[model samples]
Target: MTTSSEPRTEPRTEPHTELLRPDGSPVRVLVVDDESSLTELLSMALRYEGWEIRTAADGAGAVAAARAFRPDAVVLDVMLPDMHGLTVLGRLRRELPDVPVLFLTVKDAVEDRIAGLTAGGDDYVTKPFSLEEVVARLRGLIRRSGAAARRSESVLAVGDLTLDEDSHEVARGGDSIHLTATEFELLRYLMRNPRRVLSKAQILDRVWSYDFGGQANVVELYISYLRRKIDAGRSPMIHTRRGAGYLIKPAEAAAA
Candidate 1:
């Protein structure tokens, strides 16, 4: 037997970031689901992975947490107390549209899956989701969003107008447009989901970061802001639907 004369040393593994951010801090995440146990489990798992995590039980809470956390990503459940996941996504698309959302729910119906994606969710992991899979998907979404953020300009263009989320700046052709912080975020969401019809409720929830509790008129005010700077005396790029919602697109205007 060899004599025991060695210092006990714990093996070290290569360092890895749980949440990768250019800021060099762990990425933040929000988990919105009604299942308390699952939410806690996910929270623990994410924390163990070194990512910051927050939880919400209802749609309202989800919206608030998302806005406050400004999470790098969100894990959402479809059946929420106040609203459905689709509605939440609609709101997010209006405010924090580019922030990737990963949906979690027991609803495995194909239609539900399609609906979530159609509403702008980045990915969907049905209930009974594995921790490993959740982590993988979260990483994938964060990576994609981060890459998008780094594009030479976080500016998305259509026709002669461009909306830059990173800089909170808008430009028409070559002229820079000024917008308030909220207005800039709204315009950026619209630009990212170009040509998509977004409802009033969606706009209110996403941009305002909380349900206006029925305030749909805020969209009109901000749209006016965008029009004054981005479309006034120019071709109308942002259009409103009579009974539907608002959409941003190339002037090839259609009912959609």
Candidate 2:
């Protein structure tokens, strides 16, 4: 197996739409790999998509974690120190029969891919693959399996402003607004909690997936960027609460 000299820290330009379980909780995923580095990298990437992630290092751990995590999806490594990944998949299926599984194989042979699929894996990605591809594949699998619903299941609206999570489209007062991936995630976080103050700490944890220490100014910078696109030449919907944090509400509502 080969590792990238420099792994990507940010996801490629794709819809940052959030997916959730039928109960409106974050979608759960299990990642089984003997490599700690690979598991950590995969977990961070998946969390940025707003999905909860659990990792197991071997076939036995994978099966145990699956039963407890009840993951909507699984990313199983084809090679494990303890047992074959196919064996882990078999046990997982016997317990949670319908969960989607995406195999991670170091081999690129056609037969290997077919074997995984034939063994009930929903999809497969070889090593040296892009993190974006894995995320995209899992998103497709979860959606197709009926395990989770995209935010597109319902439009998030705060007054005249509307954001479609599924299409990654935003509009304010009937006019379309464009946002970068980071900007979109920040906006979605604020919109999801309308009229409620969210501190910089919360925003950093939720949107960036890491604490910035004394460098929380990144939040201010992105909030300014969002203001230009979302509030420019209009009655403002996004508001700041002085030392508190930020909030988004209808202009009229804020006026009241």
Candidate 3:
């Protein structure tokens, strides 16, 4: 489980490290936690990524800060003094439904994580997480949200697997597939490359940038994620090359 307190021996770089708001403003992030020390640590890490930070210690304060700061993203704690984290998020969603939120909590149970995500959390970092992972997850969420805001209107298609960059929507054979930010980007890279075998190192470098330390397992994990969503119960488009890399092509294309 990745948490914010995990120590890192080396620095990590994000693909959108220099990302700004659509309006050319610095990206803003609201950090909500009753723990002042934790908030400080999060703020420092986010600031290092060039994002403006707002801190809130309670549910009410979080809601007020969200209204005032209009952060591009939020790092919300599930437990609050005044209210439960989900309640606060429910309120925030009414005001800013499109804002991406990442949850922070000590609950490490599978069901607890599911509950948090089912509550509309874009992602979460459990207790004792590495700040690098937190930053990576945040970058992924913000990148996808920003892409949606920009509405680039770019579309990529490969053997019926289609992704609309502008709308942040993916579909396979008219069946909609909902994917997380990272998953979408990973698919986009695969779709762009089409049947070409892309090594784990290549995928990591291109999709996650060099900051993720070229973790091959991460690549494999996401590939399995994509396979489940886009290929299960359908003609498979993603193929593994054993010791080589992964490739995405139309099922028919592969046969041909």
Candidate 4:
């Protein structure tokens, strides 16, 4: 195993041992990676979130764990020793279609990131990642999943763009817009605050989490992602405010 040159802050030793679901059940998470130490560290941090965690060091073990533990979410490593991460993801999807997955990979290539998401991952975090960021991402995923399950609102709209929280659907001018969990959350935040300039810091805090200590560049990356999917080939609704931040508004409102 190769060691990262990046400085490692000592991982928080104490776990949040009492985390539980709304019904008083523990939030279950399966951590999959060949690196035992990394999995141990992640398990500790996630247990801090009051989640019950099960660990798997290889792809087959990951699938088995997911099936037996019935986790609400999965933190998966891309390069597993026994099988590829996406292969494991495929098996997990077959068993638990709606369970949100966050992919962890060492590569930062665009194609690799796209492939992971295209394969049904809800979010991607590159390695050398902060445990705080992982926890924040998991929190966001679980929160959104819970919201989608419980939301009473039928729809949210800012002009022609519409998002149905209960249905887990989005559309613009009658054209369906497919979105991953993270994209849906980010757009939901923007639509909830239509026309208001949201700094990257604010977006990160709300859409990601206040606990996420990762770089602000991830905000920029996902914003571009939203533009391509939501605004492409149409009158643009997502606007960059240069150094100020970003905003989503009706096209006419932006032109005004």
Candidate 5:
């Protein structure tokens, strides 16, 4: 572990602890790295964003800190002495599956990345990376995930179905529904455009980032994923227009 050449200040209490808005709270983050100097540097950058920050130099400490802090998300290192990052992540998934994970490691191989994702990483950033880039990536995850942590009644309803945007919980006929991260985003977009036709290409453009593998089929996959939860019983609210694309509206919403 290396120390930063710059001066350090005593850490402050995170502002986000009091924040409970759908717009988001100041992020609570766990920085796990074997290098103390790099961890400090990253912590400094994250603090400037007014984020609540904590640091761990090894996998064991990372797990302990995470369990105690209960951060909104984590920035993990792939290498650690006490245990491998992958092992820590597996434990994290079982204990805190909803917390978004961003892996920062030197393992840049494609297979390494696939393994991380399979192990439940939400995003990955290779080491020797820019602090600004890490900050940006972390912000994006927080924006998407912060909703699920708060008690929320703010909802968007088209007909019989409802999506609590603040809570990120979906329901139909008053029963709860669980959706993956991507499925939530896709449904949010469709609900925002209720009764309007959204082409697969448009859905791909909005839901997926530019760097994602250009697989249009991902839209098809998630749409089915949504249906199993949102439309498995009763009449289907989401309809496929054989040649057109896809659209969502309540049968009553259509009449209205």
Candidate 6:
């Protein structure tokens, strides 16, 4: 399998929806692939979405990991060194009948896709696929399988500022605010940890999913963008701690 040639530096601004289990735990996923690099890449991407991930190199390892991990979803590679992916799928279904499975294959043949679906995969993606597509597919699968549920309050509020995870809406003091996908993600992260400082390294790793080789200017750039929309013409809630990082609090709390 080959990795996509697309640049990975830019932060994914997609609506950052946090899916959790009914008990408010991270969604668990098991990824099965022989390529260590591919599994690592996939693990990083999924973890950024706030899902717990475990990986296996072959069919036996996949089954063993699934038995222990009890994943809500599985990303199964069609070609395994020890066994065909279809065999693995059958074994998985027997144990977790309702779990969603997404098949990854190097083959683009129609028969291959049909065979995977016929064997009970919930979805399919060919190799050289984008990480964004894989994460999106897994999100959908997890949601549909009844494994993930919207939090009791889909909206997160810190004082007057509110963010609706479902609608991707942001507002301050009853006034509507607009944000780019990336900006929304940044704001959400800040609001999620109100009053706590988050370092640039932490922000870069969680928001962008990788290190920028010590280039953290992107964080500053996006923070500026958020301040413009979220704090302009008002008592600022987002604040920088010089060398520390950034944090968000209520306007009243900051004033106090």
- CA lDDT of 252 in candidate 5? 41
Cα lDDT tens digits for candidate 4, 26-145: 478999988888888888777545456899999999888988999999999999998999999999999999999999988889999999999999999887878888887887888777
Candidate that would win on TM-score: 2
Give the per-residue lDDT of model 2 (tens digit) for 199-244: 9999999999987987889999999999999988888878989899
Top-lDDT candidate index = 6
For residue 220, what is the lDDT in candidate 6?
100
Off by over 4 Å in 6: 1-11, 152-256
The per-residue C-alpha lDDT of model 2 at residue 252 equals 60
- The regions of model 5 sitting more than 4 angstroms off are 1-25, 147-256
Clashing pairs in 4: 16-48, 19-50
Q: What's the distance in Å from true for residue 21, model 4?
A: 2.6
Candidate 6, residues 1-256: lDDT per residue as tens digits? 3455221433576445567777555689999999888898888788666567899999999999999999999999999999999999999988899999999988889999999999899999988788888988998999899998754356766667879888999999889998999898899898776667899999999898898998999999999999999889998889999999998866754433
lDDT of 2: 0.84
lDDT of 3 by residue, 1-256 (tens): 3455433424655333245565434578999988887888888777665467899999999999999888889999899999999999999998799999999888789999999899998998887667777888887898888632232337666656668888899998889999999999899888756557889988888888775754579998999999999999888889999999998866653455
* Local distance difference test values of all predictions, in order: 0.73, 0.84, 0.80, 0.80, 0.74, 0.85
Steric overlap count per candidate? 0, 0, 2, 2, 0, 0
TM-score of each: 0.51, 0.63, 0.54, 0.53, 0.49, 0.62
Question: Using TM-score as the measure, what is the rank order of every candidate, best first?
Answer: 2, 6, 3, 4, 1, 5
Sort by lDDT, best first: what order?
A: 6, 2, 3, 4, 5, 1
Model 1, span 1-256: residue lDDT tens: 3222121223334223333355434468888888787887788666655566889999888888877778888998888888988898887666686889998877678998898888888899876666667877887888878722222435456556666656666777679887888888898677655556788887887778787766678789889888888887777989998898998766543465
Measured by TM-score, how close is model 2 to the native structure? 0.63
Model 4 misses residue 45 by how many Å?
Answer: 0.6
Judged by whole-model lDDT over C-alpha atoms, candidate 6 comes out at: 0.85
Assess the local accuracy of residue 12 in candidate 3 as a C-alpha lDDT between 0 and 100. Answer: 57
What shift in Å separates residue 83 of candidate 4 from its native position after superposition? 0.9
RMSD of each: 17.5, 9.6, 16.2, 17.7, 17.8, 9.6
